[model samples]
Target: MSEQLAEERASARPIPGQVGGRAVMLIPRRDPGTDESMLPPDYQRIIAAVRQAAGPVMAREVGEGVGVDVSVKAKLEPLRGKLVRLVDRGWLQKLPDGRFTTRL
Candidate 1:
């Protein structure tokens, strides 16, 4: 791993029960810090669902767990987008095989 990745991994502290009764690893705020005010309600729900699963979950599985009607492609699309955004934001890690897990 690169030095930055190594440092990030090392610096992350485990936050128990931060999500869905599971332990989550969180990297301390680097500067401006976490802005919960910016997250939409749906996004928060998705995060909670991801935490409950507590592993590298596929998009469809996350949507199903979150109670989204997985039978409809349209409904799944937005949820998938939200999951991607969460991964981009460093709150999640996308595995090489396209699975997702909490960054911690």
Candidate 2:
């Protein structure tokens, strides 16, 4: 794997319950009728924070909502990455202005 890819994977929170002791994706794409309980606790918190927003939100706002220390830029990067992943996986929408909102 590329160095950047490895770093990105390392930064993400590990999903529980391995496949034959190998980790699997706990944050699978949100499908119709998908249960929120299927996601890891952190991912579920991100989704809940976004869903409760009155409008699209930035990564920092999401960090605050989920109790991450938003004062540190480095700390927010992982949260931002998770948000982008959700957008890619059909769990959320990234607006043209780069704010995020629920796809529903």
**lDDT winner:** 2
Regions of candidate 2 where Cα sits further than 4 Å from its true position: 1-24
Candidate 2 structure lDDT: 0.83
Model 1 deviation from the true structure expressed as Cα RMSD, one decimal place = 11.4
lDDT of 1 by residue, 1-104 (tens): 67777666555543434778777544233223443333556666777777788677888888888899999999988888777777776666788987777765
User: lDDT tens string, model 2, 1-103?
Assistant: 6777656544555356677888756566665556566667788899999998898999999999999999999999989999998889888899999999988
Predictions in order: lDDT: 0.69, 0.83
Clashing pairs in 2: none
What's the TM-score of each model vs. the native? 0.61, 0.74
